[model samples]
Target chain A: MKDSKKQYIRGEINKTGQSSSVGLIIRQKEPNNLETPFDQVDSFLTPMELFYIRSHFPTPKLELASYQLHVDGAVRNPLSLSYNELRDMPSETRVATLECAGNSRVFLIPQAEGAQWELGAVGNAEWTGVPLGALLERAGIEEHACEVVFEGADRGTPKELPIPPGPISYARSLPRDKAMQQEVLIAYQMNGHDLPQDHGYPVRAIVPGHYGMASVKWLTRIYTVREPFRGYWQTSDYGYWDYLDGKPVRRALAEMKLKSEIARPRVYETLAPNQAHTVFGAAWAGETEVTEVAVSIDGGQTWAQAEFLDPIQRHAWRRWKFDWLTPKKPGQYILLARAKDANGNVQPDQHDQNYGSYVINHPLPIEVFVDDLGRPGR
Target chain B: MKDSKKQYIRGEINKTGQSSSVGLIIRQKEPNNLETPFDQVDSFLTPMELFYIRSHFPTPKLELASYQLHVDGAVRNPLSLSYNELRDMPSETRVATLECAGNSRVFLIPQAEGAQWELGAVGNAEWTGVPLGALLERAGIEEHACEVVFEGADRGTPKELPIPPGPISYARSLPRDKAMQQEVLIAYQMNGHDLPQDHGYPVRAIVPGHYGMASVKWLTRIYTVREPFRGYWQTSDYGYWDYLDGKPVRRALAEMKLKSEIARPRVYETLAPNQAHTVFGAAWAGETEVTEVAVSIDGGQTWAQAEFLDPIQRHAWRRWKFDWLTPKKPGQYILLARAKDANGNVQPDQHDQNYGSYVINHPLPIEVFVDDLGRPGR
Candidate 1:
């Protein structure tokens, strides 16, 4: 939570980049801009408070006593549940990493632009909750129905969506199939403690896969429609780029891209001659397993195999490591890492910058310092 | 977002005594409590804001000015980025729905267990951002690296994880291969506006189909490690019971199940004489696509074909409808809808609840209204 607690996991930059009120290079005062020092070299995981915060608005505080979740409409029984009541119901849990679509936007060349997050906009966590499908069955549904609509507590008109014939707000729909999947959870706890106020306290829905928007926060209502939800969020925003048309196209929901990242050795570290350094990073898939990972030094000239620490959690990130023999003569060394999932998705050297930000797969790089003795330096 | 805008969809109770939130429900704050109203008439997509909301905690209002996303540890460049800079980089967008592992958890019984969300938990929206892989590439990874860690603004030390030795934060990791796919996104906008303050505004990551926790909101930092994340969220909280060992094996990430729901006739509605009624709903899958949808008015005794409406998106939801001839009797009529996707995954009649509150799929039902003359009541 403080710069002092921020461990220097990765090495230090010889010179600072730009300055902002929100980051290490830039001194920021908001939680969104809070940065942890990288000196602490713990094993693989990053602590929670030290984790980066990516928020759209300010953290909201709600009186637990006044909060309630309501279920009604096409259901035979209408009910209102308190946080305690929700917790009392059957509990379930899941481990996942939520990454912003623009976390790595800084690398895009020609600056086809949008959010400039270099790579500090993502985190992984465990969510605990009750399955949403269970509550619907309790409500007792009627026949002759079609679509399920999700609503959130956030209020604002998105600029990207077309104004609907009716008053527009944020909303999206799921087909009956997805609506019934139990993975959909009304989560109440993060890790093991109560949900954080900043994360959506009292309760939030954990929708696996898809983009973050579909996982509406501060959830308030549920709508069942025979027609598709045509809210501004659906028709106008987050659609897709028509690569062929060189314009936007109507596409399916976005899923996690095959991805990999280095987890240690903050850049610009000096290595002494004949020293051995260990490299670390993570990889993941939307719903599939991470089958393999490869690492390359010398600007990706050649590659070697990396080891995945845990292969049991298929959808979860797999830790990998490769031992780098210190360079005999150190000048400037560029370290590169890339990975592939079981699905045959290969990372791209670089992504095409489009107006509507989407689909990026570029190799990650790191710089290592090897002293004349060829050993890692202090 | 007002209570008047929310809606809930539903269908008839099934053999498992389960129902689904298939239609639109409205949210209205009344003197009594949060008023959630369901529409029993025409099946149509629910409007945004009017859509349902499901969350695990109070919505966080992130201030972009103070938000800082940090990329450190195990890279050539350990940098921090601000919201404004993120907007200047290349951007991407996609239409996707994030469904909770427990979205339809109501289907679970022994008496409805866990987070009691009745269908408003999931939402569809257009997500925009840069791929996390792109940023990692710019950071320059080193060899002997294993994993990348993601952290959020929310803080809590819950169940202890097995990865790191100390009390770690909520975090998860990805192996190298899966981390570099095109699907992974560092999102800055949702439904086309700066992300709503409640959602991970300034930034968040979208990981397609795995689970919501994987898509960390209010993202703040990225860490590289040799082992996968072992925070409470990953090891103890989100892990599932697989029934693999003599006891249930803990499954790490929640996977979606094949499911369906009906979103038409309001329960307890009266049917008029000689009036035609329409049956509607939508469908989805983890890796497969919903290819077929079927409807039944006689409670599984008989079934008829339904029509599918595709608006161009693939994974979002495919609207489906069926027209039924007016019934000749005045007795209660039951309606049901089911789907089959491109991968041939069919909606199941009943899905058993898993231990970790993961993806569940169950058949959907609808109760039609009938009058003395055998017609549907409006």
Candidate 2:
């Protein structure tokens, strides 16, 4: 990013106070990373300003008049469509939750390097755009094409990356089958408004059910690669690294695992004894629907079913609530919540992931104090 | 704080997204604690929303129509003023910096108990209200008065407080001389706007050059006590516990120490070699003026004087900038900033203060990567 560009963005940020009303906390400034507070995620559609931002490079300056998305490689016809031209095509809108692959890296007991995110690096938004399948169908993919690669306009040589020194476009690839799924969208709108700059203005890829890395922002190109695209994002970063039987196992992060988070009764929150308190939280799953959520207020010794809120949308999170009556005794209590998805995946009791802290869906222990006379209300 | 009151406040916070634009990150939610990101303190007068909040209890809900501030004790004429009545009096505005005593507790090696604040737990703002000196003069303080105690409306039994379990109002006291300073204000306005709810809406005490704990929020009572006030905030919580001359010395926290913080070129920020980058930051002092600010690029071995910006306000922070020309050889560089005050006080290179992490003015080391063939426009 240029100093001049940074100054411009800073001026805009100062003038408009972007995301000031979204309750999202900034993690990094240059690449412009932000995360939402878990408790602030009370609605099914995450506010645009509260949406978590994960940028590999500074937001690119693009003019809608000149912005062109090129679709080429292993295709019968290479097409370069302008912003308006692309928007004029058949469009579909879907509610999907996008989560960073390293969402809960900070929660890892041993800690991990990267953005020290808690549980705020995920948000559900209504995305409107043309389907990637429609675009690929228009381009006529070749019979041997095995991967679809998306490249964002934002480009920079990541500082400390061991790769050879050269500017690289932020890119990620998806298998042919996933790329053809109708749920994958070339999004130009978020929620109900035009996509914000930090969220990929003009156009971006919205891969429902997959980690945000697969949903390339500030998108500029779509390539039909005959073989699996070996981009740095896919080969070096985002991929999970762990050991099984003393053998190294590497898996590229894709679908988000079943996860549940206690939004209410924040850590160290004092609760009034014998009072009924409503425990609110959110639960999500990748591809599959959340079937049930359980709450355990006594260090997970026993579990009770929680009521799921109405209008549970596909590819989006489901809100759950439980009426918890405080124990007659006043002391410290560890609260835990877990979700079970239709795919038979249950939130794990502990996180043992080693590589980059990816897919850590371990139920976090929320410590709350039960004080009979701590404070009025609850 | 009652649960209903908390829910009401949460509803308001959700409706307005109170801290959304301020870039202040939430540290704890129940007592409503927030800290500003170091880089977000760009201007001399921090936007009201960006000001760091340190509430020991939930913000008290008070209606301006019925709000009353009682001034009694060692005063010739006890005064009780309503919100409107208080505003009707002569008002003065002063730019002052308010810093939590534990602004950089997170950086304390070996760690410390309490909110792990980074550099963001401080902000400079313009406070508008009648000076405490003016108010005290109107009340005609008794000659025997030795201390002035300010008590806030917010009250609750602090969870895990070492003291006996009971509800306690948040209170602090000032020496007779400090209490009569013209800079001490019973502020009702912040940054040209009525104070926000979290910022002590109707009225709050503003003690310039003193730590934030002295500026009691949601102020409700003021007493001209004949002897020193022995409140938990003053004697037990905020006091420093450290060994001096082989004996324990417990000193009450008062004015802030000389401090400087780098606001730009965040940690691990990659810079392009051979590029001129301007490093921006702010420096502040307590009861003294910052004389100079120094920047070091090579691990503090060599130092260079940074240029101070214009319009340095009294009792507020001074913005400083350093033009750094990156070395041709690229690797990693540690940047450091320190401030010296007129009272012969210099920011220490290391933090050794143990209790409550008060007045920690140690120069923080910022690591930045310099890539030779990195992207242009640093």
Candidate 3:
């Protein structure tokens, strides 16, 4: 990238301030990687500013007036449509949570060689756009098609290895079954406004209940393949490698694991003594419903159920709260919380270590102090 | 406020999107009260949008081109300065944390009769403007004045207030000594940008290390008084009533109490088993410096010291981190953190309940879950 072009792209990224006001932790400047902080998850609809940004390369400078989406391969008819043509199609909206496969990679016992994200690399938003299934139906899928691949406009050389030696466009493939799910979207709007450049200007893909890698940003091409697509994002980068039966095994990443996170009383927060406080957080699952959440104020010695907030929707996280009364005694205390989903998957107490630290789900322990003073004073 | 006026003010508030993208929890629309979610404190410099907004009335629409700030009372020469004139004066910038006196009111056991805010009502930011001391020095102080009063442009009838039964402008007073402090600023910029409307467009006061009520927003008037100002906001609203020696005593709110809060591993976060996770949060004190911060992962049974991040500025928060190693055996656990300032003010274990829930500094407890599966599965 030339100095002038780089500076121009940097200017365009700065223009995002006009649309959203949520603080984002910028992980990389070139690829424009940003993550949302956990506390900003108080609202059901993640504000556009707080939505996490993940890109393989710098944002593509595309003129909205001339943007086009090409759909082809393994079909009776291939279709190429302009940005307006796709917008004119029948549209649907869904509130879904999109989490990076490495959302909590920083928590890995042995640090991983990827974005060291904590709890901010995930967000829930009301996505509005035409369903990818509708586009696929219009293109008429061939019986031999086994997978669908989505490619983005941004292209660059990935830092990690064992892939193509040169520049490659960011791409990922989904199985035919997952591709045809009604919730899969060719999203044009996030929250309510047109998608921001960081999110994928003009258009992007929204794969509900799946990790963000499947939802390619700066979307430009869609094609079907006869065999399962073997892209780097699908096979090498996002997959989990672990020992099974004393042998190493690699599995492709897909639906997010059942998980829950505390959005308030962040780590090391101090609470008031003898005061009634509400403990709240959010719980989510991949294709399953989070049924119950529990809280432990006495270091997991005792457990109490939490109440869920209204307007619980599928593919979206459920916010839960518990009213807590602090003991009269002043002392340090540890608080713990866990969630159980409809699939009978309960949040575990610990996760086995992994090199990549993908899909970490362990009970997080938070410590807070209760001051001895009951009233405010100098 | 009239319906059309209300609509216009709302439009101005929406325009804040241009200056900041931090998610703000809007408490009420008419009075324009907003709070910052605690997790957004990932960085030391709080973004403009995440800065808490507290107005007793609707935002008064003022044209920037015609705006003027008046300085009078207890001065040798009264002066009226335009925005550009103030900008041209010698200026300084300071990083300060401004917290509402009633930030954690919602956590009050008896349920305070005000906006229910959890840990999101506080934020830190770099403010740029002329120091109040410099401006006051230019005007010269009069001996009779004991208090300096700051009045804002917003005006309305406050709900459920005992005093001044009709419409009144929001105002507060500061002691002469505090007013003369070099750190007190007549601020015009937040985080290096022009102040957003919700955050006192054109100019406001920046009282370093003081509760937000002292740093009045949308400031229009500055004057000194012979006696302490007895406005509703000064005496009735932001005060505490506690029994001293079995006698009722009332104390007005002032500097923020020594406090600390967790920024990561939010309330109900899940952890990975057998992994190393960094436990991090932020801590701040009143006029004193935070000397030490401790973490308790086993319900306070064991305490460890956390490392502080660089550039720990006064009147601002210090970010701290701890490397936590999850036990190979996973089930459930509680986490806790506490802080002690240079003045020997250690975070108390509990606080006595107060009506307004002001200055709550109890340690916050966060609960997290750990999954049984040590590795990711297909």
Q: lDDT of model 3 at residue B251?
A: 47
**What is the C-alpha local distance difference test score of candidate 2?**
0.79
In candidate 1, position A46 carries an lDDT of 43
Query: What global local distance difference test value does model 1 have?
Result: 0.57
**lDDT for each residue of candidate 1 in A270-354, tens digit (9 for 90 to 100):** 7665666777767767666778889887888898988876564733567677777777686778877788877787677876433
Q: Taking the tens digit of each residue's C-alpha lDDT, what string does model 2 give over B86-161?
A: 9999999998999999898887777867898988998888889989988888899999998888889998865422
Clashes of each: 303, 3, 64
Fnat, one value per model: 0.00, 0.00, 0.00
TM-score, chain B, predicted structure 1: 0.77
Backbone steric clashes in candidate 2, count: 3
**Tens digits of lDDT, candidate 1, B11-98:** 2311122233333442222111111122331223333333344333344556878888887667888778888877777877866556
lDDT of 2 by residue, A129-230 (tens): 999999999999999998888888998876422232356678888999999998999999987678989999989999989988999999999988775554
lDDT of 3 by residue, B1-378 (tens): 233222222111121233334478887776878888665455566656566888777787777788888888778888788889999999899989888877767656767677887777788788899998788777776888888888788887655322333466777778889888889999998877788888888789989888898888888888776655656564346755443222222345778888877666666667777677777778889687887889888777889998887355789988788888776666677777899898888887776443245677877666666654646511
Q: In model 2 chain B, which range of ten residues has the least summed lDDT?
A: B7-16
lDDT of model 3 at position B106: 65
Q: Where is model 2 more than 4 Å wrong at Cα?
A: A1-22, A159-161, A242-247, B1-378
In terms of docking quality, model 2 is: incorrect
